[model samples]
Target: METKAISLGRSLSVPFVQELAKKGLISVPPRYVHTDQDPPIISLDSSSPQVPVIDMQRLLYEDFMDSELQKLDQACREWGFFQLINHEISSKLVGKVKLETEEFFTMPMEEKSKYVQQGDLEGYGNMFVLS
Candidate 1:
């Protein structure tokens, strides 16, 4: 019997692997396996540093001083992305929206076929567009 070798990427979780094994798609042993031996390299001597951490709470609660604005501008210019520590958006609503979006995307093609866009008219199914 020919055994097929499978390559598991770095981001895949172990539980996913076990689930695949249970489904009999891939025959993975019941032990942790490290397929790749090469480790990621890190440069210690480089002067350029990692992304800067932004404190959103400070920006929200404290007075918006010139120094703070400068720091914010500098962060936007340098990193282009920063973490929001204290966001006001509700986590529950976000999760619900995410779930709904996933469910909508996973709907059957036949079901999705019901929604047809018409020219000029903003309506579902067969419709004519008004110029």
Candidate 2:
């Protein structure tokens, strides 16, 4: 599988978007963008209900497992994403990781390309999809 992915070709680069945006093309390329009018293709509304924020600390309590599991299940079903709080990971390390990510994203695409895995699509770019 890893060999198959590397042979598929290089992952997509966000710097391509940056170049386009510099020319005032802020939107994605046409292949990835949609303007369908038959039915609205996107939603930008924020007044709807919010995504769940799970408390990781509750998972430590065996007695609270059932209720927490119910919340986790509902969150997974409704939003498919959730923010975990109080997981005990170091906040300093988290901040450093985020900072490094920002730095990597801001680096020139040529420099970032150094991270592309020799065997897989795990890199500073998009997935195995050719687009």
| Candidates' C-alpha lDDT | 0.55, 0.71
lDDT of 1 by residue, 19-106 (tens): 4555786555634444554433366856646556666666765575455567778889866776555557799988999998788656
Question: Pick by lDDT: which candidate is best?
Answer: 2
TM-score for candidate 2, residues paired by index = 0.61
**Looking at candidate 1, what is the lDDT of residue 16?**
31
TM-score of each: 0.32, 0.61
Query: Number of the top candidate by TM-score?
Result: 2
Q: List where candidate 1 sits over 4 angstroms from the true fold.
A: 1-48, 62-65, 94-131
Cα lDDT for residue 14, candidate 1:
33
Q: Which ten residues in a row have the lowest lDDT in candidate 2?
A: 1-10
